[model samples]
Target: MTADRDLGSEARQMLAERTADLQAAEAANEALRRANAELRASRAALAASEARLRLALGAARMANWEWDPIADVVTGSEGREALYGRPPGSMRSAPEVLAAVHPEDRERCAATIRRAMERMPGEEEFDAVEFRVLHPDGSIRWLRSQGRITDRDPLTGRALRAAGVTFDITQRREAETRYRVLFDASPFAVIVIDQATFRILDVNTRACRDYGYSREEFLSLLITDIDVLGDEAAIRARGRAHKTGERTQEFEAVHRTRDGALRDVLVRVEGLDLGNGRVTYGAHIDITARKAAEVELRRSEERLRVALEAGGLGAWELDFSRRRTRWDARLAAILGRERVDAEVANEVLSRCLEPADLPAVQEAFRQAMATGGDFAAEFRILRPDGEHRWVRCWGRLLPDQHPGHRRMAGVVADVTEHRQAEERQLLFMREMDHRAKNILAVVQAALRLTPRHDADSYAAMVEGRVSALARAHTLLAENRWTGADLAALLRAELQPFLTAAPEAPEATRILLEGPALTVAPQSTQALGMALHELATNAMKYGALSTAGGHVALGWEVTGEALRLRWEERGGPPLAGPPPASGFGTRVIEATLERQLGGTVRRDWRPEGLVVEAMLPIGTIRAR
Candidate 1:
């Protein structure tokens, strides 16, 4: 039994050993498969990385190169060979590559190369340098070369061979230069401000000059400090508004300079999004003169509106170059037509002109154009309603020096009412002249009525009476003979006596007072004569002949009647009433009673004389 157990155990052990061998072999095969897969993945990764590198180089139009210090040879890739203007591998040595450097840049390039080769400990691994290189086509290109040591001396830590990339940076440099030129030379002021602090970040050349600040000084200031119209809080608000918004804004603001002068500017602000925060780009354009002009224009327009309305005028302009006419709305109304457009063709306006006066109008226009002169004429224009209306036309030529291209600006007025008024005035003058002639004839007849036996007294009376009539006529003429101010009439008649003492104040020696009363032309002469008689009596024998004597004459209106009183004082006494009416008294009674349609009454007092007159107010014509 021991022998059988031993043999079975040995068989089991043998089978276990064989199974373990097979498992080891399977483990080895799986490990080998994994290694193969890893190798393939690494190859794929390297290919992808190389492809990416090639794509980057192509995008940047850059070239890779290797320089060997020992061999003194410079090797370039297919792309670098193209930059050198040669076929691949045409450049054989470092000196050949260096030969392509521009003469002005060759030394600098060599110095850079030497410095890079002498890399010191703790220095940056990468170095970048820029230089100009002359291509085979005789064109110079700005090249930027960046490199690090690919092979170095172990003991000295010095670069033995270097590998780097080169790119044609000509376009970039040109773009940078163009930006600088535009930013520095623009006419309008430009500014950049930081969004968070509202502090000025940058300013252009114009900004420096316009704000009266140096570039360094301006950059140190907050935006609000330069704003004459706003404070810090407002500037902060403006900054906030620009930061969170995408739309641009335009505003008017007053900017103050370092010299404390204020300038009106129109500012246009827009957001500039950057990595740090929102930056504000602002443009300031001056509009001070334009603002003043606009204000003046508004005031002038207002004045023109008032004048047109007050004088019943209409403004017109003709642009001869375009043969276009423009007129105010009032022009159409004055022509008795529907309001026309402010601008219209010339023929449309010329259609209204009358042929009789058209020649004068045309001549005026021609003269203005030829001589750059003023045009003025009275013409007639028929309205659409078929009524002829007289119009006074006036104009002036603009662009005075250039007659060929000019505008005719003018005023037009309807003169029908004025012309009719003038005609009426002429007719009235003729009537007044006829009436004056009749008055003279009446005076001649009255002179014949005077007693010839008292020749000296008759001549004196005739002269005084004629003068009184003449005085009345003058007063009426002064008013254009419309009527006379009753007060003025009395003053005129009493002028000789009232001012007899020039040293005395006016109207004090012989005081006169009355309500404003304008007597009609028919009554003015008669009333003036009556007052003259009374004044003559006072001067000859009554109040005016004595010192400290006066005559008080006054009138008031009541119940459509004028109650007037004349009181003489401080003069010779009247012992009794006149035995009968004298020439002067008779003249006063006749003139006042018949011509003025009034009555006169005389009272004989002990110390002086008093006269009361009743005149109808309706006849006096108080206007």
Candidate 2:
């Protein structure tokens, strides 16, 4: 029984050991199954991800390419080959791909790749550098190449693979070229500035040449340097406009040139927000010459105004369409009215004219307008002070280019002094001629009255009288036949003999008195000769002989006649009124009779000599 029991125990132990081993084996098998299932799932997921990547690449028209620098082999999508302008399967080697690169850009592309490999072996890199490639059809297209370093082979010290996307940007590049041609060739000067730095970013050839600066130099300058406002104001304003997206309009200001000279310019500034930041564009038009011309025209107008005022001429303009009349300040002042209300029309202006003169003035204006020619009229204006003044109106009507807006403009001048002078000249000519005839008759009479044996004395007296008459005419001519002052006349004709010698006359010997008055031309001539004759006689033998002798001269204007009284006191003795009919005495009588149309009396009194003359006021008034 013990042997049997021992055998069973040995069998059971072996069976248990076998069972444990089986369980361990099953566990190991189950774990292996799970790992196999996980591996399958991972493979499926990877396949799905690759499919999605291909779809995305196709949708985006993007091509993936790999380049192995060591093996010189390139692997890429069909689209990549298309972008490279190469035949399908043609870019299997680096050399094959490089063969399509433009000759001009081959060096640049090689250099960029070399630098990228040295800097970043297994890291990604990208660049938008422009490159050219030969098309499959023998044409050339511009392209923007982009790439990444995918892997590096450690054993070869070379690129294992580089992945990149290349897009055909030929149309974009062509459009840019077309736009650049237009932008550079525009007539208007255009500039673009970086808002942040206020630095000039881009300028065309015209802008550079206009500013007298080179393109590189212009890009280095700040916007404020050439800005119309200049300095900080320009910077601040440009910043504000850029931030607000505002479009500035024409503003007149000055800009500084490269040489620091200021030029008047009209500027229009605009802001462009380009998502990344801001840019400012400006257009400039030089207005310096136009401004100078406007200034010169204003100065010329001012000079003309000064000349008109100095000449005392009044200017006016009439607007026929509006029935309005415009007058300058001087014109208003001449008409004795305030300047502000001077633009009134014909109604008010007509009231300023005399009743008879108003008709003549209206006729003149009508004729001027009808003929489009010059018209002149002399008329009288009734002043506010109840006085009449002679006015000469001269005008020229200009034909209007506008159908209904013809007008007349002209000047008005006061001709009172001029008219009076004309009248005086006419009267003096007639009177002087009449006096010459009368004087000749007197000479004839004197010659007849003198004895035949006294021919020499008679000739002397006639000659002296004619010379005195001539002297009077010379004095009248100096005054333009207008008039002569009494004091000036006396001094001119008598002062020479009164102070002929160094000895001064007695204090009481000469007397002269009168208020300031203008004597007529006729009166001047007549009185001048009479006074000259009297002075000559007095210096010869009358009141001027000694210190005790005295002469008195007085004159008065009374209505129609001017009365003159000459008295002599304490002469050499009592002079009996020029006992002989000498030249001096005859001249005095003739002047008073003919020129003055008055009488002269000579008194031979025991008390020296006395002479008095009375003349008509009208005759003297013509002076």
Candidate 3:
């Protein structure tokens, strides 16, 4: 049984060995099948990945690329080949790539590639760069390359190859350049600033020129640094408005220049949401001249005020648009107003003028405005308190002076006292002239009644005659009589002398020549008495002794003299010197001497007696 068992065991052992070998072979076959399945899956995935990559490159207008740094081999995509004006698979080495790159940028591209390779192996970083490529056809192409280190040796941890993509970006680069140029050369001043800090982020050339700050200097500064408004409150308010996303419209503000000058600017500010916070974009329009004009206007107003005060004159303005009148304090006071309302109308101002004088005042004002002429009006004002006072108003026109606005303003004055004083002075001068004439007439009359003597007596006689003449003047002035007629004066003075010669009046020859002339009171009294004495003497001895005898008496002002002449022809022979100087002769001599300041000569000739008197032209009377 052992032998048979041994034999059976041996057979079983051999069978078992065979079964084990078969099982082992089957297991190995199953392992190979699993490896084959995995290989097939990997191959499928790789094909799909390659297809997807190709589709993506085509969609982006790009081509795939590779580089073997260790071998200095370069492989480019179809797009890269096209960029170099060559067919696909044309680039075979780094030297070829260098040839394709522009000569100016070739070395720089190599350097950049070297730097990329040095850092690539462990976890390559994606990088992008731009360079110009030259083609065999002599054309230049702009290219953008995006790449990463894909094939690296794990053991050495070194980049063996790099994979990237290339695209033709010539048109895009040109567009970018044009946009930059336009932004730089724009006319409006543009500036970008960080909203929170108000720090300048960017500024255009126009902004730099307008603000008088360089780009570097402006970027370092805050908006407040350039804002000329020194008030901190206003700056803070503007900052708050910026943060609230409000679109600031045009606003006028002052800006400080590099030279420390102030500039007026109109600013438009807009907020930009940059994902982190807000930034401000501003456009500035310089209006410095306008601001200066405003300041000048204010100064002009101040000057006007000073002028009015210095001239002691009042000022007034009328605004037709506002329907108001602005009357200065002095002008209101002249109208007896305690409280003045500038809002009053023209009618109210006119009411202050006297009613009877209103038409003249209105006419003057109308003419002044119509012709743009200087205005002057004198009128009485009816004060609020019922007192009537004179006022003189003067004005000048200012036309087309206010730009974009119509306005007129001028000064007025209260000249009542001045006008009144002038009138009073004229009246006083006239009275003085009358008084002086009266005094001269009185002296002439007083002199005519005195006796002839030496220079001293003559002076005394002239004075006394003047006194008597003054008395006569007083009578004339009492009646306001200007003068006496020739007939009236003769009749009044010769009445006493003619008492006995009533019938023999014709015997006396008194021949008066020339036109009748009137004489004032003093002249009449003095000359009348002298003439009466001469007539009486003629009647007694000179020419009136015989009816046939005749006497001639004539008076005239010829050239420069008041002359009187008396001649007798048929009377008794010429008489010798008188026994004494009679009152009549003295009166005649004094009359000629004092009143006419003249010489009288009496001569006794063979035929008759002749008397002639000559007076100065200055003392001659005017009719």
Candidate 4:
């Protein structure tokens, strides 16, 4: 029984050991399966990465290639063969690929490879070359080749193979060529400046001519050397302000040339971040002519402003497209606006127009727009100060080729003062006509009262009286019918009858004296005519017939009355009185009594004849 129990125990121990061994084998197999799965995943990822790289190369118009130095085998990616316009993997060896290399670059390419191979193992090994390739279609392409020795012989010290990347850099090369052309041949002056030192880096041909400097001279100088027209600090500040962003900025500045001439230029600055350093590219456009034109335009505007102000004028523009109105400073002044930048609109102007005048204004605008007719309309505007003013607008159509919306521009002026003056003129004309008729009536009466028995006497007297009336009319005209200066009137009336000098009096001449006064227009003619009749009597028979004869005429203002005395001395002494008051006597009596509302009484003295007149001062206004 003890032996049987021991055998069972041994069998069970063996079974457990076998079971442990089986479990170990299963764990091992499980680990192997996981590792296989990971390997497959890694391979798939690598393939995907290579495909992505090729896609990237194609997108960039690039290629990748490899070469064996000993066997001279050429292998490349699909993108690599497309660089030379060939099928992928078509080339058999390095020489087969070299067949596409430009004849001039092939030898150099071979020499560069040989040199790279001669380097020692473990030495910094690299090969970089640029060469052109000829395609089957005969088109040329540029390629950039870069490589390094990947395998070398241990015993012979020979280059076995190289691992490299080659790319079709034709687009990049073409871009570089275009950049060079633009930099060298730009029309506006282009200057490249180093940001840190403000030193000139390069300049285009136009820059050299514009600045009056050679390329070498420009490159050697700093920005401060050329921007000589303004303060250096200011120019630097402007540049710094513009440099805050990479966007292109424009500014106007005066720059100095090599010959120290100042020139106005419009400068456009662009910031370039080239990774290694920052550079500023400036394009300078000569705007001296434009600046001069601007200055002249300002001067012209100033003159126009002065003229507009002086002429009480304002300028206006109606932009039909915008349904807006624009006005200048003069217009603002006319509108009584305080600000020059006052806003103007069609609605605002329309509201300013008087209700009655609006129709006329609208009709004028319509006519101008439809028929391109000259526009002249007078309207009334209520000023901001609540004063109404008359304004006349004159407009013309603006010539334009645009098919839609007409434009009219013109001037407006305040014609209030002019209108007032015109009214005054009309009043004066009517008064003149009335006064002229009255004088003609007085002349007719004088003629009728004259003696017809002596025809010659009548004619002589009429001529003389008419001449006196004409002289009075002349005085009124020169005074603008405002009033006649009393002294001036006397001088004018007696000028022809008297000698040149008044201080040196002559016999047979009339000498008159009076205080300075202004006679009313109404009284000037009457008083002038009265003086005429008295002087004519003295000339024919009284004091003025001989050189020794003389007349002394004087007047004085005495308490609401003008007492004037016309006295003759040393004349063919006047007989008592004219037989029957002659035409001259009637003229004197009618003018003084009826026209001036005064009386004329005569005092015939033995020495000469004295005519004393008493005139009411109330009729003659003093200015």
Candidate No. with top lDDT: 1
Model 3 clash pairs? 446-465, 446-466, 447-465
C-alpha lDDT score of every prediction, in listed order: 0.82, 0.75, 0.71, 0.81
Between 1 and 2, whose lDDT is larger? 1
Worst 10 residues of 2 by lDDT: 497-506
Q: Could you give candidate 1's per-residue lDDT for residues 1-623 as a string of tens digits?
A: 99999999999999999999999999999999999999999999998988888778767778888888878888755478666555677677777777777889888888888887777755648777788877777887888888877877779876678888888898998998799789989899999998678889998889988888999999889888889745777765654554534547777788898998888888888878888798888999988888889899999999988999899999888989889998887887887766766678988778889977777788888987778779999988998888888899889877657656779898999999888778869966896887778688758856876567787988987888888899999988898767888898999888878754554554466888878878877678878888888888888878887776789999998898888898998889889787777667877777778757888889878667898989877776734
Instruction: Estimate the lDDT of model 2.
Output: 0.75
Clashes of each: 0, 4, 3, 1
Give the clashing residue pairs of candidate 4, or none.
508-549
* Deviation (Å) of 153 in candidate 3: 6.4
Please report, as a residue range, the 10-residue window in candidate 4 with the lowest summed lDDT. 499-508
Q: Higher-lDDT candidate among 3 and 4?
A: 4
- Please give the TM-score that candidate 1 achieves against the real structure: 0.62
* Better candidate number, 2 or 4, judged by lDDT: 4
Q: What is the C-alpha RMSD of each candidate to the true structure, in Å?
A: 7.9, 6.5, 19.2, 10.3
- 164-185, model 3: which lDDT tens digit per residue? 8888788898898797678678
Best candidate according to TM-score? 2
Clashing pairs in 1: none
